[model samples]
Target: MSAASRAGSLPANLQGLWADGLNPPWSADYHININIQMNYWPAEVTALSELHDPFFRYIERLLPHAERTAKKAYGCRGAVAHYTTNPWGHTALDGRIVYGLWPDGLAWSALHFWERFDYTRNLGFLRDRAFPILKACAAFTLDYLVKHPRTGKLVSGPSNSPENTYIAPSGERGWIVMGAAMSQSMAFAILSRCEQAAALLGVEPELRARCREAIANLQRLEIGSDGRLKEWPEEFPEAEPGHRHISHLFGLHPGYEIDVDETPALAAAARKALDHRLAHGGGHTGWSAAWITLFWARLGEGERAWQFFEKLLRDSTESNLFDTHPSGGGPIFQIDGNFGGTAALAEMLLQSHAGRLRFLPALPKAWPSGRVRNLRARGGAGVDIEWKDGQAVSATLRPETTGTHRLIAPQGQRIARIEANGKSVAWKDEGVRLARGVVYRIAFQPAG
Candidate 1:
């Protein structure tokens, strides 16, 4: 996947570098709703940041076309891209309204920019490349959002949860509705990031203030009566109980709004939602199962994560190792699942999203001993870990910037020793502050 998305060229599409025939599946096009975005999920975490360049370039090229679509389609400011796009930068809505009318593509796609900046801590990239796109996305979201008549909270309307539908109480099957969980989550992600970027750059005071106020007024994720995260503003019956798309869990995985530690309640709701989906035969496809694997890893369910990972491999994989999406005729190749599985495996080993590097946060008992080398983390750090009996035994940390680094012992183990360039370094439960370009080695053992 990384090789397919070289810099100065188009990002990897559905077929990636290979197309089976002259008339490839979905024309091997860019699907912004999730497919295209999922293609790059492993780029930063798996130590392939350069592979993300083509996607960023693609987003940059999308600006002009997206701007026109935002105005012509919805008369909104800034920009909006719908569910699908192509190399020529077609930002217009395509296909049926159920799957095509979504206007949050630019917001979700722009998150790659923020993720890159967050991982690299590149001020120049954030300033010159990312913030502009983020700001534009925020601008469009602010203009697109409106106060819900009853709830009085800002909500996105006429947008479905990325191809999922619901049956209203009146027995009407509907795809478009107000305040879809995925839409709100995407809005919150983009707006909050924009505010952070503005604060970091010390520019766009008015835009920053608007974003802050809008965030305050945005509808929060709600827990349904069934203890699941509400997919829509109301408790409408799902058109398909086991729908393949679990867009409501977007905040839990790709977005950091929901966390197992910080927002335990929301995390629980998300877990219930996932359970409900899987109980109803969700994750029936390769990419969907791969996404579920990542979600389980994020929620720290190592066994469940491993189960889904295996399902992705056994049920959705071809003999040649290509991810296969079920079709009317037979299973067909799709590249997102391959990339998503790579990212999920990396997530199971090390996670750095929660303000600290968590070593093997979701190491499954099935894999009692393992080693991973050169897994990248956010905030410009790299990690290499070796573990036995599900406990981290030794690890190396390489920071590209000077700062106070925080490292969490895997599975509640204790750090027994720390060495920096063969010299003992003072440390505590949190971690040690280190200079850039220094190699830190840590040894861990089971606690008590």
Candidate 2:
């Protein structure tokens, strides 16, 4: 997926020569709910930054169709995509409201631009290309939101939690509801990215202010009565206790809002939700298992993360390391699991989602010696690390731009010395201010 995406020649789903029969399932279209998005999870982080171009190009091609979808279907401004789209940028619905009514698709797509900006810090790209798409999506989010009658909070309505259903308090099963946490979280992310873009570009003050105001009115994620993060705004019983899609945890992974340090309660609720899902039969599919691995890494649980990683490799992978989904009879191929697992492994080695470049946050004991190069991080940094006995022996960080970066060294490791291009330097607990194109090396030993 990374190589093909980098070449800009990969299909939305890479069936290659393996595609069977005339009527392949789903017509080989990009399923935006999670599949297409999952395929690119490793691109930027693994330093295949150029791979994002094809996706952005696809988004650009789809914008006009998406705009029509938004205006015609919801009477709202901006763009919208259904569950699936072909290479030609078709944006029509799939006829099933359960997965079809998800307007969050474009909002979620906008996040790729945000992720690219996070990795590159290329203000020109953010201003000229990424911000326009994000701002348009934010406009859609603003226009698409309806006031919840009970709480008056801005909410999205008549949307399912992306292929999942719930039972209401009135004993009726429904796929449509107001404020599926996935949509809310995606909107929040879009708006947050727009605000940040505006700040970086030093333009669009009105848009930034509007985003701030709308953010205030957006629905808040709440822990359900079951001690888990609610999939929908209300405490509805899950139609499938072990549903494969962990949509409610959107804010926890891929999205930036929920953090263990900042929102411990929500973090705990996310963990509980995962436990609930796993206690049933969730994470059975390859992509879902990959997502679970990512969640565990985000929670800083290396052992649990490694366990799931192993599970994905064992049960959900083909001989070529491509991911496979479980059919009633046997395994079926899916590209998302492969890409998502790639991202998950990178996360286990190094994480930057919490606004800090954390080294070896979830390095598993199984991988005692390894080296990774050219993993991108937020704040315009590139990282390369080598570890032995699960301990970071040395790591090099290159700053593409000059800034003070909050650096989190490997847990339980003490820095024996730090140097910038061989010159000894003082490392501050707050952060290290770096110059453009300069490399900082840290020599560390295990903590006693």
Candidate 3:
């Protein structure tokens, strides 16, 4: 993969060229809105953490150029990137208004750094590499958002939900608008991570405080009148109701703002939105299908998630396994579907996003008997689980750093017994305190 990718273009190329052409469709540029980010989706989940080095190197090279672009384009401090960028770090602001004005590109890319740190738990990397990028993303976000005069919410404006358009109440079509849920959600994610990263370092109290304040002012996601999370804070009808991009779901999957446990109402609304989209012919693209799979997994709907995965395998791939995007009159390959599907599959087997290691939270019935090993969890834990007949039978956990962490059974399924280092341990909602280098084994009671 590395050799082939490097062969395509120097200075690292996320969008690898399948065939040689100077003027390929979409210019073969790194699409930051989703494609470029999706290319690396499976890095940590598939245990390909080292493969992400190229992407980080690309970002490192792009940062200085992005800083200049931010100041020149938006008159904002810190770094920013438009929807499309090239290997030379040239930020493109073409005539297409829908794709041109997005500043959330950097915020989305910065997630890779945070995700890498989550899997590795390298304090040096978090403190030195990831935190700086996250801080800059937050800085740019802070500078970019303006107070919405009516609502007083810190919001980004004149930004379209990536590649999506809507119809105004005045019966006019609009692509660019204010406070798109995607932008606000991305801002919340970046700023929230900045707060977490800063609190971890403990040396940037002022920065941390500002991030906290910004977070407080950021617009909270609101559901529309139709029982769906609004694409924009203002209720506008989608120009393409079946649009494949699930940008509004940023908070549900990649971002942690909305969850099934804490934000159950919003989570339900998101599920309804997904149902509506699917009913209206959404999830047509491979990447969109993969995201819906992840969303279902996050919602613990294994059957639904697996159904999407099956569709992806059946409809969205070439013989060689490259994802095929069937837009622009014919099928063109996009690697994001492949990577995103792999990550979603992992999410179905195990989820650690909410500071808890959940076993088979969304295990599909078709995968009743299977095993997964060496999956990384937050707080530096290595997890391996075996299940049979749709129930987790046995599991093992090893933590790189000693700490107390929650280990939850699948939703309502209870852990009949848990043993740590060959001794019985009590289960608490707050979780158990674990020591470094200790191997904990868990066993579940047989199903009736």
Best by TM-score: 1
1 versus 2: better lDDT goes to = 1
lDDT of 3 at 182: 91
The residue-by-residue lDDT of candidate 2 on 122-156, one tens digit each, is: 88889888998898898888888889888999987
Clashing pairs in 3: none
Q: How do the residues 355-413 of candidate 1 rate in per-residue lDDT, one tens digit apiece?
A: 77888989999999989999988888888999887788999989897777678887678
For model 2, what is the error of residue 15's alpha carbon versus the real structure, in angstroms, after optimal superposition? 3.4
TM values, all candidates: 0.97, 0.96, 0.95
Q: What is the lDDT of residue 79 in candidate 3?
A: 87
lDDT computed for candidate 1: 0.91
lDDT of each: 0.91, 0.85, 0.83
Stretches > 4 Å off in candidate 3: 1-22, 446-448
Relative to the true structure, candidate 1 reaches a TM of 0.97
Q: Residue 364's C-alpha lDDT in candidate 1?
A: 95
Ranking by lDDT: 1, 2, 3
Clashes of 2: 0
Candidate 3 overall Cα lDDT vs. reference?
0.83
Looking at candidate 2, the ten consecutive residues that score lowest on lDDT are 10-19
